[model samples]
Target: QVLCGDDRIDAAVTQVISNLSSPFRSGSLLVNKIEAFEGKELKNVADLSAVVVIKSLADTTVRTVRSSRGQSGAEPVAKLVVPALAPTPNYDAALKQLIKVCQEVHVPLISLPGFGDLAQIADEVRFTFLRQLKLNSTRLHTFLMNLVVEEGLEGLVEEVSNQLNRPVSIESAQFSLMASKNMGGTPASQQRSLVDDVHKSVRKQLKVADSNDGKDWIIPTLKVGKRLVAPIMLGENIVGYISSMVRPNDDMEAIAELLRPAALAAMIEFHQNRQTGPMFAATQKSLLRDLLLGGTLAASDQERMEQHYGFDMADGILVFAASALNAQGQPLALDGLPDSFGVMTEIEGTATVVVPYLANSGKTWQQVAEALQKQLKELVKQKPGGADAQIQIGAGRMSETTFDLAESYREARQALIVGSMMHTNKEFTIGYGELGVKRLLYLMIDHPELERFCEEIIEPLESYDEEWESELVPSLRVYLAEGANLNSAARALFIHRHTLRYRLEQIAEILKVDIDSQEVLLNLQIAFQIRDMMSGSTGKRG
Candidate 1:
């Protein structure tokens, strides 16, 4: 409609496409390099460079249009073209035809200064197509709206990234990274580093939650490093979050505006899919603490959580605790190894993992530990500056329900503490059952009944040994510890079997109980443990 052809660079590509007759004009230009066709059988039509030459319709003959208004008909063969766009040709079939048709004939496509120079075309194509588009408000809205028709949150996130020419990420309300789109060409490691920084920023904000007494005090938009973040809030609650990299074309202001509607669209999307509650977790930590501390959930919270995390408390469960040591042998917070294995949380300074157990299906704790160690090794390799870090894991006994998991959680943490004390400078997986007498010592060390029972059982033997100057107590201990084996106890005592038998009989007479009875032997075995603990001896390590 302009009196003269508007020669602005923005309209140059359009003007060149417009010069062709109607059908051909609609086709998109394929400015890809020619060398990209290396593997394919190409019709040696033109010696185009390393990139694609022309992607327009036909090859040799083109019906140029001098007729948009009053004129009509072709004006001598000129511009190149591609498969028609109206009906939208099957891409695969259309590409095959284009390759086949190029067997002969060469036609010059539309050319304009600064836009069509041989050197600038490939750069232009890459700059325009490979990068995120600098979209205006209307175009951005249209782009995001169009993507909503596609299924999944991934499509929406990906398209916003594609058109916006930036890194766009979607995270569950708990700030767990969910989906990401990056067109700015950042390396994966750097991206992960950036994500970590963003997570810290968000968590730093969440720390404010505790002080605010759960009131909605989270900042709506958080700018951390080079990323701009916004919550996808549904009134007072947040369902998820959107984050984008800050840049000239897509700065904080633009990203903030984009996230506003994106949040609504995301909420609508989740709503249409009939999801329940916040998308992931606004109370992720609270839920974690309550369950792990005691596995207690209010009926309403439990029902909603059941629908949210889709887990059943009736399932058998095992709890694990993990700690990492840096190269300097200092403790580092565990790096999501527990998380990769199962539902994970941080309690105190240790990483706690609650893995659903399937005992009815013949699953055992050994199998779980083995699988977990294997996964942990793989995940450790991904942590930065942690190549030399050591991971020490401890697991608790298999539990029958989420309620029982509380004990397992405590045991898991205890195992890590006790395992580190017992197995210094080595990696270990110490189950609660593995601690043996040491566990008993730890639990009953301060119990008044423990000391009373130990005194009652052992005082007679001690008095008898002191009076007669006999080794009855040592011999008795060896006998019970050797599981009442005559020869084993004799060898342990370094005495003849008859000598040990005589001493044991004397010990039985002194204590006024048959040493060979199962109940008597059990008490004596526990008595020896008390003796060791009283004598300041932790149980021996193998």
Candidate 2:
């Protein structure tokens, strides 16, 4: 009975293997037996049947298995199985099956050879994955080199082109991708709106609707027309817009994928360059302004100004004092002036109005004076309360030499002072020559001391009012004019020499001084100079 049972068991097992190899029955019968024998009272029998089923399935697939008995008569034996070839058709499904077989036999670390084609496929997939991860040219280059090492350059190029969708050309200097476009039957180069179209396409491709839009997935596309404009964002701000003329192709994908990293780098670099340019320009202008207004200049600075701005020591320079007035004739602040004529008002009490006088003629002073006067008048008239306001100008003379500017400054200041005092409501005034010193002195006739001095000097023959009167002042003046020659003085005065002597003695007696002494002569000369100074007369004097 035991021998018959063993023979029957062997026949049943052989029939099971034959049935498992049949294409239609193999996969189904293996799966059914696994499901049916999962758990039962006949656990050992079920386990043995599961092992037979797994081995039969492994034989059809490119997989291997090793069976062994447990040591010391353990209840269950352990079997090891590994896939000799890479999983066919479905890797996920095949891997799951291999794991299931190992679990049934309680195997550990089943060694299996990878699929025949898995190396190449995995490599390509890895390249694509690495390409996606890279965000710069350097990384991309490294990936390309690795690809070339595994599969030569030509193969790499073909694979990358096929994967990305564009025509890729690699050169020593640069890598480029080219795509043809037909815009309204016009050649891309000749199309006037090519740039616009491209921009629109890029924008559209990148357009993202707001959250209010119901779509769950976002489609990223390059828009080239009015319909599409997608902003390239950096942080929260849009740095630039990207437009593409070519449709997405395998080659184009590779190019764009390559360009994405490069584009980001380029954008950052471009933004930095843009910011730096304006800063540099602003720094230059600030330096120029400081040089012009700082009141001090270095030797190099002076040379630069002279060469670039035509400022030279030989240029005739003058200073002028000017005050703006309102329509009411009241003084207006310097801030009210227009921006022409390089008007610069200093912090000092006065404004140093710069007027460029190109001509070498003496009349440059007059021209500048006239211009200032005109501007002042116009400013006064335009002011709100300028009717009563008076615009006064004091212009200094021009000097060919630079050192004389101090003199010019003094002249202008004096002119402004005297002009303001003497003339009322005049728009401008010139000084020194316009109003004589004698007349100006008479205006101070109320001063008693000056009157007393004049009276004392004209005394000795105050009653002699005639031109021929032998007045003490006239006598002394004549004597001094003749170099203190009594004879010549007497001749000039039409008096006898003795008579001149007697008159001089009388003059000295009245003036309380010696007639022949050097001290008295010096005193008299000083008095004469004082009189001339007070009178503002250039007339000849003894």
**CA lDDT, every model vs. true structure:** 0.59, 0.44
In lDDT terms, which candidate is top? 1
Per-residue lDDT of 1-542 in model 1, one digit per residue for the tens? 11111232132121111111233221133354332333454433232211133332322334454334434654554444543433322344434443444433332222222323444565665566434443454576665656665645678787667656777887654455657786233333344344344445545565677578866554456665566767654433344667778754333544566675565566655445334344434444335445666545556655665444435743577889987676666765455544335776666556777776654757678778777766666666667656766777889887775567678888888888767765554566878888787686766667788888977887878877788787777777667768899999899878899988788778778889987799988887777676665554333310
Error of 1 at 351 (Å): 2.7
What are the per-residue Cα lDDT tens digits for candidate 2 across 401-487?
334444655556556655655444455657434444433454564567764665555433344424445466777878876888999
The TM-scores of all predictions, comma-separated, are: 0.38, 0.28
**Which ten contiguous residues of candidate 1 have the minimum total lDDT?**
12-21
Q: C-alpha displacement of 441 in model 2, angstroms?
A: 9.2
lDDT of 2: 0.44
Q: Which candidate has the highest TM-score of all?
A: 1
lDDT score, candidate 2, position 283: 25
